[model samples]
Target: MVELAICSSNFTDQLALLSFKSSINFDPNNVLSNWTQETDFCGWVGVLCSRRRQRVTGLILRSMGLQGTISSHVGNLSFLRVLDLRNNSFHGHLTNEIGRLLRLRLLVLAENNLTGTIPPSFGNATSLKIIALARNYICGRIPTELAQLPKLQIISLSDNYLTGPIPSGLFNILSLSYLLLDANQLNGQLQAFPNNSLQFLDLRFNELSGPIPLLVATNFLISHNKFTEIPLALCNVSSIKILDLSHNSLSGVIPQCLGNFSNVLSVLDLRMNDFHGSIPTSFVEGNKLRSIDLNGNQLEGKVPRSLATCRHLEVLDFGNNNINDTFPYWLETLPELQVLVFQSNKFHGPMGSSKTQLPFPKLRILDLSHNEFSGFLPTTYFKHFKAMTIINETVGLRYMGESYYHDSVTIMIKGLEIELPGILTIFTTIDLSHNKFSGEIPNVIGKLYALRLLNLSHNNLVGNIPSSLGNLCSLESLDLSSNQLSGKIPSQLTSLTFLAVLNFSENHLEGHIPRGNQFETFDNSSYNGNLALCGFPLSKECEDNKTQLHPTPMLHKEDDPTFACGFCWKVVQIGYGCGMVLGLVMGYIMFLIGKPKWFVRIAEGEQQKKGKRSHKGGNRNGGRRK
Candidate 1:
């Protein structure tokens, strides 16, 4: 009887496992193909049966492209301890029957298409330790029953549609270490809670308002919130590193003591805020700072020279601010500095540089547009971008530091918000537009063969478009418009086959526009404002001297209105000239003929008639006298 009971229990487990496989409508990899009854239930894939009694204990189906709703029979696996379906295409609400799994501990459904809210029956899983449903479509307020899990250590539901204030009970979880609820509809002011062993907390991209709580955490990001002030208590957290409070309504002077974590802080991003006054200059030596982004803020005054002490600094962006300092050539000393953006500020003076300093060797992205910067293009500075002059696919700079702020940063440059999608170093670019840069686009820029974008528009640059620019085989977008550049469009530009966006508009370019390759794909807009430029897209045709051969005089189509008007004007002019010549010829011929006989006879008769009339009048007078 005991053996029969055991067999019955094992059969029931197998049936439940089979039901779970049946629910999977699509399994591209055939990961569940071997889960049939023909095979022993213990040999099934992703099924870890217990040794003593044949029963499923864990089910990990991550990244297998599995589809369809999770089976309700999954709850029948009463001995299940772990259920991981992360990074899959699983949809539908979690079965409420999952509450029957009393031994469940870790539940990870992250990066899936699962919908519906957290099953309230989840409260029955008292032994749960971790619950992660991030990057899903789950909605509804977080079930307060989660607070019952005293052993829970991590709960992440970020990138979901969850709304309402976070449960206050979650803040009091003594064993909780990480809590992520970002990128959701979660609103309401955060409430203060007593400290626990929590370390990492991210609540950004939400509508959370009010003051920040005096919490102790290692990595904290609350940006895109409505906090009006930085709590002084944050400085007290000695273990803090990577504090991002950007895109908030927080006003007032930044606390000087905020730099107290120089020893631990690696990234301090306070961009897109209302913080005014000079930036705190309390950075000391031995600082481990890697990035400092204060763009789109109202901060004034100069960049603190003390920042030069951070040898490990990689990205320093202070664009779109009220900063009134000259070019900080002193920053060239930082060995790892890669991205330097200072666009749309009050920065003035010649593009200065250290006389004997080494160029920013690793620098790939350099943007200094829309400033009071004057003087010639800094060719020497550009030549030193060793990282951008070459192409290397092995380097992972394309993927590095992109999501350090969770999303693209927006700066109000040119009175419009511009989003820096990612700080990808491999996508090299140079933007010096909207400045007073003059002279010429230096030939050295062509040496940046790996450059993808170059913007020199709205400057005072003069001279012919450099033919050497053809050497940039990888150049994609070139903007040289609104400049004083004159001369023929270089034919060598036809070599840029990868060029997608070309702008020579608003320049003094003359002669036939380049044809063939990528140049042929450009339209009139690319050549607009250049009255001297003529091509297929323009109404004006190139002069015969500019083309290889003169165009033949072809008859215009009758449907062409311009041709019709031109033809009519020519006919009228020719008719008028012919009529004047004919009239003069007829008059000269009549004068040479002495006078027609009829005209002479008529004149003689008129004189004779007048004589007769005079005689008749005299005769009548004599008769009256008699």
Candidate 2:
């Protein structure tokens, strides 16, 4: 009994010494105040010991915001099995002496500021099963010595600056179930991935180039690299559930075999690549698919009808493509749809009526701009939308009465008085221009008192500018250009004190331009394309027009009937006609002087045919044929 007591006391002394040394380097706040030899080692703050068997088994001090180095004396804790010091400010080199803890199984040092190479002596801890050092500043190649740990199962070293080839030694670890090396500077051909026991693998955001290796992992991520082609071998992984290969330089048609992953795939992202060709009809047949991101590709053709059956789909991004077809009405039937981004495409047709329903009750973001969609703006589109930003610039959205105007006004209705419930008004903007929309600028637009920007340019809109627009107190930008609008410049617009940018160019507007704070800073370009407009910026004086005509409040027809009757009409018509004639004459002269190669080719072809016919006639004259 005496000899056994002596052996136990010796072990306890070693552990106490190690803990004391490590604490000295990190106890900046002195929170480990009671860590002393006089007190039993089990009484320490994070120290855990077996009750009946008086031996320390675990030491957990995670997220204490602790700072400083991990001392080498930590090796003295021979019986410690688990050490968790994650999510702290721990720094300095991970000491090689840590290998002395032969019984250690789990070591989590993730989310720290630790730097330096992984110590090779870690291989001596044969019992170690999991080691996570992710989101740290750790550098240097993974030591080949780690392969010696026979019982190792999970190793995550992601989000670090570690470089060099993925150590082949990792593949040899047959017990490794989860391996993550993403967001690192590692490079080399992706090969030798362990097929067995590996359930999860992430190698994303690396310098890896070449085809993806076939592995049995269920969750695979290898995005943001320079891979030039889809790894058909990935199709071999029948167990894959989530596959992400976005932001690569991959080109070529998406393989039809991708549909074969229907058995288990739930999320598949292949966005931002050079992929071209029609989207496969068989692509979304999988019932389990929850999310599909194929944006920023060159895919064409209509969306497949089968996608409507994917009941679990929550997000779908098919933006920035050449997809030319009518909007998919079937999309309105999706119950779980939350985010749908279809910008920069060639989709035509009206947003369906059923879309106004609560199909996407949880929808947060819906972007469908820069497309060929046409028709009136949908009023009920935002009834269930918590927040949204929809732009229809390239589309042909014609004005459909004052109701559409009210819909635009709803975006600015904010503050507690509006009783918006849980919805805190964030950013909501509308851009409707470069289309065939027409009619007078609606006076109701000013009611959207919260409006930040209003753009109505490059359209056929006609009528006097609405003075009520000045009510938009929050408006920062207002554009009303390239229209047939005719009227005096509204002095009420000067009331828009917050307005920073205003454009009223390319219209038939005439009179003295409004001056003051925001308008005074504007140059001639802001008021250009308007023939009769005269003010401080223009060389023509406002007094010149008032002197020639009698002051009439109703703007009589006799008062310069055609508006800019004498000056504008003559200048524009003569300038356009002369420019057109000049261009045609110059083109004709160039064609005559420098005969193109195509013209010479046509002449040569005609001469060759004539020669062949003459030869045939000569043979007939020589009595070769009757």
- Per candidate, the number of residue pairs that clash is 0, 0
Point out where model 1 deviates above 4 Å.
1-5, 193-196, 402-417, 545-626
Which regions of candidate 2 fall more than 4 Å away from where they truly are? Answer: 1-28, 172-174, 192-196, 283-286, 349-362, 380-626
Report the Cα lDDT for residue 376, model 2.
44
RMSD of each: 29.5, 21.6
| Model 1: worst 10 consecutive residues (lDDT sum) | 617-626
Error of 1 at 252 (Å): 1.3
RMSD of 2: 21.6
User: lDDT, candidate 1, residue 111?
Assistant: 72
Measured on C-alpha atoms, candidate 2 has an lDDT of 0.63
Tens-place lDDT digits, model 2, residues 104-150: 99999987778999999999999999999976778899888898998
Instruction: Give lDDT tens digits, candidate 1, residues 516-544.
Output: 76766778888889988887668798767
Clashing pairs in 1: none
Cα distance off (Å), candidate 1, residue 444:
1.6
